[model samples]
Target: MAEFHQSRKNIIRLIFIGVFAVIAMRLFYLQVIETKYRQLANAQAIVRKLIYPTRGIIYDRHGRVVVNNTALYDLMVTPSEVKHLDTAFLCELLGIDTATFRERMEKIIIRNSRYRQSVFAELLPPDVYGRIEENLYQFPGFELVERPVRNYPYHAGAHIFGYIGEVDSATIRRSDGFYQAGDFIGKTGLERSYEDVLRGQRGVTYLVRDSRNRIQGSYAGGMYDTPAVAGKNLYLSLDIELQQLGEQLLQNKIGSIVAIDPNTGGILAMVSSPTYDPNELSGSERNKKFSRLFTNPELPLFNRPIQATYPPGSTFKPVDALIALHEGVITPQYGYDCRGVYLGCGRPIKCTESFPGHASNLYNAIAYSCNSYFSQVFRFIVDRERRPALGLAEWYRYVSDFGLGKKLGIDLPGEYSGYIPDTAHYNKIFGKGHWNSCTIVSLGIGQGEITETPLQLANVMCIIANHGYYYTPHVVDSVEGDPDFYRTHLVLHRITANVSDTDYDIVTRAMAAVVERGTATIAAIPGITICGKTGTAQNFTIINGKRVELKDHSLFAAFAPREHPKIAIAVVVENAGFGASWAAPIASLMIEKYLRDSIATDRLPLLKRISEANLIPEYILEKKRRIDSLNQVRDKLEARRIVAR
Candidate 1:
């Protein structure tokens, strides 16, 4: 009996020890191993506030601050903490009706949980903020939070600088908790491309709250507060004056101009016409203005420099000349007696210059932009190989090396890969063996099935200027914090074409002749040696399911100061007729402006003519008118609905 009682007592003691160990482990897990319960408990007494750092400033090449920040306030609300709120007073302060206030509150609750804070009124005007701040203590859950909004001092570079907006659900998901609702993010252009470098680290502050949900002081004496790191500034290669001039010249027109510094491939100016003020998409009216811009028929939002594509037209002749010379099919002195037209194919292809011996050699041929001469050259190249496919593949390889038919990987977003037809493309269209050089002769003249962006055309000029090498074109010259940004991002890319430097020299001379006395003579600047090419791309539109030819698109590509070219530029004026009339003159003025920093008195008249010209298509104008009328009607209806409510 004594042994039994001792064993039972010992078992009871072991049970007590096991229970104590389990209780101790549970306490440790809850206190140290898990954060959910602790955070939930802290949420009752501590309000965590996010501090948004100032977005990086943007500077032009000359160190002018082009983009800066302005202080704005957002009326934030924590729905759960909103007790005994004066709905009418709040509505009156916000300049909103009770219905609108309730609607906004409902949306906030839906988007963010009732316990969390959300923006009630964003980008509040200074006057409105002053009024709300005076009475903010009357609203229990409402807080005025200061944030930085972008400001464009010059009101230029609407497309280049882009805009930022509140983060969407998709963006929040993609950010992996880095972004939340009400966080602003870049939507396009340099803003979108350099978002990471421009958006600085966010900081957090823990504030102690009393039982009434009022902030008392910094939680834990500010021990856990983190300071926000301001975003790194960006120094851009864009010459603001040059950019402004380009925009001025392209006003009331549908076109694009891209100018690059040949030595560094830094974009000097990029202009897409019909541009709006950058301020239109900032501050309080951003959403309303953005909606209108998005629906505009002119497509002002489109980044035409790298997004729109057009045939290279005669500007492509130099590339063909180089290719022919490399293939040994034509020498620099090779002559084609192009008298009006080429008769090698069943169909006749006419030359722009009908005079005899106009295209007597490669130099004259390029200077004259003779279609017949290049057609024969393309035929010789294709027919030289046993199969036309092999010849086309070779041509494709050469052109692709010049950065056609692919994205140039420019620093901007939404770049379109211009199309270049190859053997496979022809095979799919006309069957493998049925198509030959004659079937696709237009490719030689950069017309049928060959397309390139203005960026690509400018890049081609850079290659010619550099004797077959180019750097990836970029806008940002350097980031403030990172010194190796340019070297690491905008590296030199050499063309793999087998053409020698002599071939480039031959082409360069011919291009100079083009500006000196040939097709683009009007593009000549008095002191600057401008080597340029004129292009008139045939444009077409589908009207009522029928292909309708429209006025040709005027284009010009050029490099200045022939010996050591500083600037390479491309201009495309949509539906503006002959290249020399619109595009060439524009290029000349731009070149002179960039080189001299001002248009000469002699050229001001030409600049005035080009700048005042209105080339927007009639159809586009009619469409815009119709859209404006519809928008007016919609606005009236919205007003009526609000009045009825």
Candidate 2:
């Protein structure tokens, strides 16, 4: 019996030893092997704040600061660290009501856990920040964090520079853990396209907190801290002075202009009318101003240069001229009897030339902007092979080579591939083999479903200037410190119309004559040989359930100096009559300005007239008046210390 008791005691001792061994191993794991628990404990006690680096400054080609950064403060809060904070006083300091206070607090809690920090009120200007800063100590769990906000010096380049805003829920999910709520992100334009390069790396700093979660000093003597690197600077090819001039010229108008250096494909200027101060879209009043802009009749945000597609009008004649010459269907010596109309299509399509054989050859036809000459050329292009579809298919190839009906893959976003119809497309529209060249004769004159962007039209001029080749036009010149930047930006494309330089020379001479003494004589500049084409696109709009014809759009495409073209430009002024009256003259003035650095003394008066011409319709002006009056009433009511209903 004693022996049995000894064995049982031994078993009990072994069980105790096993329990202690498990405890010791767990202790070791907690202290050495597994550090997750320790890390979590440290996280609660150490407040980590992101140190945002300054965004890089944007410069024009001439080293002008187009965009720079100014310091702003973000009021951050740790919900768990709050004591008996003065809620009402805080509301007054933040210029918010009680409802806003509750809403912001609720959002903060939802975006970050009670223990983690989040933004309370952000983008406070310096004056407001200075007022609240002195009393910051009275509010616990609240800290002022400094970050950079974009400041536009000229308030120009509104659409080009874009704006920054809080990261949306969609962005957070799409970013796959890269971005978090309350993070600032680029939403459009160059900001969105170059985001990866523009958003500098975020850095972190850990601050020690007591048991009560009050800040002390840096955690671990700053061993775990990281310093943020500033974003890389961008050098754009845009000439700010020229850009501002174009913007001024297009003010109160409803169209766009695109100018490019033909040799380098550098965009010298891009202007989309009805511009707003880009500064309005930043800082404390961004939301309110954005609401006003959103409801404005004139689409200040439309980005017409790249996104708006319009009928090229007579500006498309050069492309057709080149196509006809390339197909071996016509030569520079081809002549047509045009008595201001064409009778072969069984309908009267006016050529606007009074005499027969007026378009005696390619030179005279283009010089006169003769429609009848090209109408016959169009039929030949579509009917020469006996099957009109086959001939049209060949014609489409040449036009496509001219970069119409397709996106040019510019660095900018929201570019539309202006429609170019194929034989299959024509078959769908009008039954297969049923439509002939006469059915779509308007295509020859750059109308009837053939459309192009202003940038594409500018590229047409660039193509003619180069005689057959072009680089993809771009605004970005290079990224600072990146050797591969230009390599990525400079891309060349060659268009083979199979036409010789001799053919282009003939077209150039004809265009020069058009500017000198033919259709667009108003576009001539002293000592500057300008080649230009004038076109008018008929416009219509729907009103009161009826289609009403408005004024026609004025369009012009031009290149200067004839032999060595410096600038190629396309201008379209909406609801402005006659391309010669507005678009061509605008292009000429712009060319003179670029080449001579100023308008000649004689042309200054003409420039003043163009700038003062308010093409914005009277109805739009009246609507703006009503909106402004209403806003003034609201402002007066608020000033009287009355609450808005």
Candidate 3:
């Protein structure tokens, strides 16, 4: 009986010790190992606030501030903490109705939990913000958070600078908790491309809150507060004055202009027509103005320089001339008798000039943009090989080397690689062994399935200007914090094509002749040697299931000073009749403006005429009129609703 009692007492003591150890471990875990419980406890008394750093400023080549930051307030609300709120007074201050306020609250609850803070009113106006700030104490859960918004002082470069908006659910999910519901992010252009470099690291500040959810002071006297790091600034290669001039010239037209510094491949100016002022997309009226711009039939949002593609027209003749010279099939003295037409195949090809000796040599052919001469040259190149397929593959390789039919890897996004049809493309259409060089002869004249972007055309000029080598074009010249990275990652390295310098000289001289006394004579600037080409691309569209031809698109590509060329440019005027009439003159004026810093006195009339020209298609105008009518009706209804409120 004594032994049994002793064993029972030992077992009871062991059970008590085990229970005590388990309790101590759980207390240690709650106090040190796990942070959720501690965070929950702190949430009751501490409010965490995010400090947004000023986005980096963007400067033009001359160090002028193009994009800067301005202060704006976002009205934030914590639904769980909102109680005893004066709904009518808040609505009055916000310029909203009671129904609108309730709708916003319900959306916030659905998009974000009731306990979390979300933006109730974004980009508040000055007067409304002032009124709410003065009476903020009356609303316990509402707070005014100051954030920086982009400001364009010059009211230009809407496409280049892009715009920022609130982060979407997809962005938040991919941000790894770095971004939340109300955070702003870049949507396009340089803003989107350099988002990481321009968006600085966010910092946090902890504040002590009273029982009534009012901030008392900084928690722990600001011991845990972190400071925000400002984003790195960007210095762009864009010449703002040149860009403004390009925009001015392209007004009332649907076209694009892209100019590049040939030596460094830096973009001097990029303009897409029908652009809006950058200021229009900022502040309290952004959403409304954006809706109007988006719904416009003209598509002002389209970035045409890199995104839109059109046939190269006669501007592509120089590339063909170079290829022919490289293959030893043509020479500077090569001549073809073109008596107004070419009857080499089943179809007769027409020539623009019917005069004698206009295409007697390679120089005159390029100067006149003779269709017969190039048609014969293309046949020579293709038939040189045993098979047509082999010859086409060779042609494709040479063309790709010029940066055609592919993206140039520009810094901006949404670049389209223009199409270049190869043997397989022809085989799929006409069947194997069914088509030959004569069937696709139109390609030699920069038409019939050959398309290129304005950017690609500009780069082609760069290749010619550099005498067979060119650099990848870029907008941002340097980053403020990391210059080495910019140089290493960007196109500091030169890319060389397979053409020889001698062939380039032959082509370059012919192009100069084009501006001197040939088709693009109007592109000539006094005291400056301009080498240019004119193109009139055939435009077509499908209407009512039938292919309808529209007015030709005017195009011109040029490089200036001829020796040690400084600027290379391309211009495309949609639905414009002839290249020399509109596109060539525009390119020349831009060149003179860049080189001479102003238009010459003799060319002022030309500049005035081109700038005042309206080339928008009639169909586009009709669609825009319909959209404008709808927008006006909606505006009237909105005004009526506001008056009723």
Best by TM-score: 3
Question: After superposition on all CA atoms, how large is the RMSD of candidate 2?
Answer: 3.4
27-135: candidate 3 lDDT, tens digit per residue = 9999999977776667668887777888889999999999999999999987766889999989988879999999999989888767667889998999999999999
Candidate 2 accuracy as lDDT: 0.86
Question: Comparing candidate 2 with candidate 3, which one achieves the higher lDDT?
Answer: 3
Per-residue lDDT tens digits of candidate 1, residues 1-645? 999999999999999999999999999999999877776667678887778899999999999999999989999988866888999888877778898988988988887767677888899988889999999989987888899999999888988999999999999999998887888999998889999989898888889988877779999999999998888899999999899999999999999999999999899999998898998888887988899999999999999999999998989988988888888998988888888888988788878898877798887888888889999998888888768999999889999999999999989999999999889898999997998888999888889989999999999999999999999999999999798887798789998876799888999999998988888888888878998899889998886799988899999999998999999999999999878889999988888888889888988888888888889999889989999999999989877865654
lDDT of each: 0.90, 0.86, 0.90
TM-score-based ranking, best first?
A: 3, 2, 1
Give lDDT tens digits, candidate 2, residues 543-621.
6789988898999999988989999999999999878889988888888889999988988998899999899876677
lDDT of 1: 0.90
Provide the RMSD of all predictions against the true structure, rounded to 1 decimal. Answer: 4.4, 3.4, 3.8
